[model samples]
Target: MAQQVRGVVARRKGEPVSIETVVVPDPGPGEAVVRVQACGVCHTDLHYREGGINDDFPFLLGHEAAGIVEEVGEGVEDVAPGDFVILNWRAVCGRCRACLRGRPWYCFDTHNARQKMTLTDGTELTPALGIGAFAEKTLVAAGQCTKVNPAVAPQVAGLLGCGVMAGLGAALNTADVRRGDSVAVIGVGGVGGAAVMGARLAAAATVVAVDVDDRKLAQAEKLGATHTVNSRTTDAVRAIRDLTGGFGADVVIEAVGRPETYEQAFYARDLAGTVVLVGVPTPEMELKLPLLDVFGRGGALKSSWYGDCLPSRDFPVLIDLHLQGRLDLGAFVSETIGLGDVEEAFATMRRGDVLRSVVLF
Candidate 1:
């Protein structure tokens, strides 16, 4: 039987999201039904509400979630009912070129529930990032569920479902941050702060955080940032270079998703140092740089998609680390909110007052 559950939905462009009755069908082939326990309020959710992601009206507006698998469709052997899992947007198809090449993180083909979740009037809703989860229950591809240690709280583990994963992956995977390396992360919000934490986990000698807000910089310090630069009043590039013994950082991660921050990351890295772009930018945003400087930089300039993470491999390990107190996942959760507080959470997020305001079911 189909279930009708309350979910946050953006019914039209540039409008506020509301709690609406969402109809979720039972899992079809290769699909699963997840009972969402907690979902994080990400900037991307607000983007969907503002029609920035697409014209897919009535978007189901949450993705960073952790839940229990309530049911699985035929041929689904990976996850069974009652398993704790973190929901991932990317469900790699093994036959895709990227997957066949053993780079499933770059999988060109990802899967989602083939059946649509609709409204009371039968209007189809687009699930944000293919894993709409700001509801009591959601339907997704079986591969979207990555099992993690159940010992961790759902709200903390759910962060790995999106932003936090992206930040950590940017440092660990994209930039290949290593012990003794010096790293600088621009825009120390949820994602950037996670990058700082990732560098610390990698044993980086220095983890410098740059942000416009002093509060976020302080938050980054708690997350293992060795130094903080308030870009609002400081020359970030110079500060980073001076901190790194006038050589700049070995790896600079840009998490602001703006041309200015990207340029800062580029100039703040040592010659031949890697620059990782993890920030999400709008389509209208364009980057321009000197061709000579590009050649002279002599290092990789990479974009981190979902933190270049393989969810199955990364989620479980991260959960274990969190369980052992090696990773401070709890630091990311600024507050726990009820489902109805999602709209207010957006305002709080925009004000840069909190790292994350997670909605608990």
Candidate 2:
């Protein structure tokens, strides 16, 4: 039977989200219903609420989530009931060309549940990032459920689903940060802080954090940044170069999507070093760079999508690292709130008051 659950909903652009009754269908073929235990409040959710993503109104908010698989439909063999899982937006279709070439992480065709979750009035809701997880229970494609160790708390586990993963993967996966590499992360927010942590985990010799906010720079230091730069007061590129013995970082990860920060990242890396962009930018934003500089700097400029992560391959290993005390996933959860506090959480996020305000079911 279909179930009715309370979920966070953005009814219109620039309006605060409201709690509404969402009709969650039972799992259908290739789908699964997960009972969400915790969901993180992300900036992207705010974007959806503000209609920054599209004209899709009445979006079901919240995507970074962890849960238990309560039921799995026929033909869904990847996950079963009672499994602890992290819900992900990318459920790779095995037949896609990316998958055929064995790089499923770049799978061009990712999917969600075939059925639409709707309002009690039967209006369909566009889920945030194809996974509407603010509700108590949500439906997703079976591949979206990545089972991990049940020992980790849902609040910490859910983070691996989105921002945290994006940051970590930006360094570890996309940048391929290696031991002895010098990494500088710009915009030390949740994602930037995670990149700092990733660089440390990879045993980077120096991790310099650059941010306009002093509090975030402090937080980044706690996440293993060897040095912090208040980019607002200092020339970020010059400061980073000075810190790296006047050579610049071996890798620079830009977690702020603004063009200025991106330009700073371009100049803050050593020759032939990589610059990874993990930040979310506005659609109308444009970046102009010198063509000569692009040619002069013989390095890779890459955009990291979801940290280039493969949910099935990345989630469990990351969870295990956290369980072993090698990774500090819990440091990212600044506060926990109930479902009703999502609107307030959005305000908190905007003010940079917290790294993450999670909604616990």
lDDT of 1 by residue, 1-361 (tens): 8999999999999888899999999899999999999999999999999988889898998999999999999999999999999999999999988999999999998989999999999999999999889999999999999998898999999999999999999999999999999999999999999999999999999999999999999999999999999999999999999999999999999999999999999999999999999999999999999999999889889999889999999999999999999999999999999999999999999999899999999
TM-score of 1: 0.99
Runs of candidate 2 exceeding 4 Å displacement:
none
* Worst 10 contiguous positions by lDDT, candidate 2: 47-56
Q: Please list all clashing residue pairs in model 2, or write none if there are none.
A: none
Instruction: Give residue 33's error in model 1 in angstroms.
Output: 0.3
Q: How many Å off is the CA of 182 in candidate 1?
A: 0.4
What are the per-model C-alpha RMSD values against the true structure?
Answer: 0.6, 0.7
Candidate 2 residue lDDT tens string, 12-96: 9999889999999988999999999999999999989987899789999999999999999999887889999999999999999
**Cα lDDT listed for each candidate:** 0.96, 0.95
Q: Write down the TM-score of every candidate.
A: 0.99, 0.99
